[model samples]
Target: MKDTKILLLLVIGVPILGLVYCAFMIGFLLLVPWGQNHPIITAAIFVLTPSIVSGSIWLISSARAKK
Candidate 1:
């Protein structure tokens, strides 16, 4: 039962936070002058950062579950 709550939090919370972060980043990238200078970096940050974070979380959780 406790695990169910944690699972639900993980499923719902991470994505909502990710979306909010993405929206903020998009706005930041568009509004800031520095953001305009490097389109590739901005694009990569939007694309890669979340995958890396989520992948790391998944790896740690899976490892914990195996124990």
Candidate 2:
């Protein structure tokens, strides 16, 4: 893969995938009728999941660049 391609993907893919994951997770959480209705947990889900996913994407891209 080319450097430009990798950079472009990192610019685009990280936010897109991270947001998708966050939306999906939060949407599912809200859609459910049962569960511990905790605000902190919800906040953590909003923050952590996307962050971890984005970081993972970045790490993967870094690894790929090394290869």
Candidate 3:
């Protein structure tokens, strides 16, 4: 029961935090004229950074699993 509640909180809270962060970034991009001008780079950075980070985490986890 306790574990279930903790898992439920994690499921709900993580997405809320992600949404809030996205909202802030979107607001910042809109507020900054440079963001409008260099949208491609900004988008690439946002999209690729997560991909790279996930890939790195996956590699580390896989390596640990092998050890």
Candidate 4:
């Protein structure tokens, strides 16, 4: 039961956290002016950072599990 609960938490929590991070990144991008150089790079960074962060969090959490 405890293991199932942890699995459930990871399944639900990771994606929700990732989506929230993505939303924040999108909001920040929207607030930025379009005239800047390398807009594509900026956009990529905004999208990728949160994803990487979320993946790292998931990896770390799973690695530290007692099982």
Pairs that collide in candidate 4 are none
Collision count for each candidate, in order: 0, 0, 0, 0
lDDT by residue for model 4 (1-67), tens: 6999999988999899879977876776667666154678887887688679879989999989956
Name the weakest run of 10 consecutive residues (lDDT summed) in model 3: 42-51
What local lDDT does model 3 show for residue 65?
100
Error of 4 at 39 (Å): 2.4
Cα lDDT of model 3 by residue, 1-67, tens digit: 6999999988999899779868977996999898889999888877787689879999999999999
Alpha-carbon lDDT, every model: 0.90, 0.80, 0.87, 0.79
Relative to the unseen true structure, what is the C-alpha lDDT of residue 39 in candidate 1, on a scale of 0 to 100? Answer: 85
Tens digits of per-residue lDDT for model 2, 1-50: 99999999999998998788768777867786442476667678777875
Which one is best on lDDT?
1
Cα error of candidate 4 at position 37, Å: 5.7
Which of 1 and 4 is ahead in TM-score? 1
Error of 3 at 61 (Å): 0.6
Poorest 10 consecutive residues by lDDT, candidate 4: 29-38
Q: Between the candidate structures 1 and 2, which one is better when assessed by lDDT? A: 1
* Among all candidates shown, the one with the greatest TM-score: 3
For each candidate, C-alpha RMSD in Å? 2.4, 4.0, 2.8, 4.2
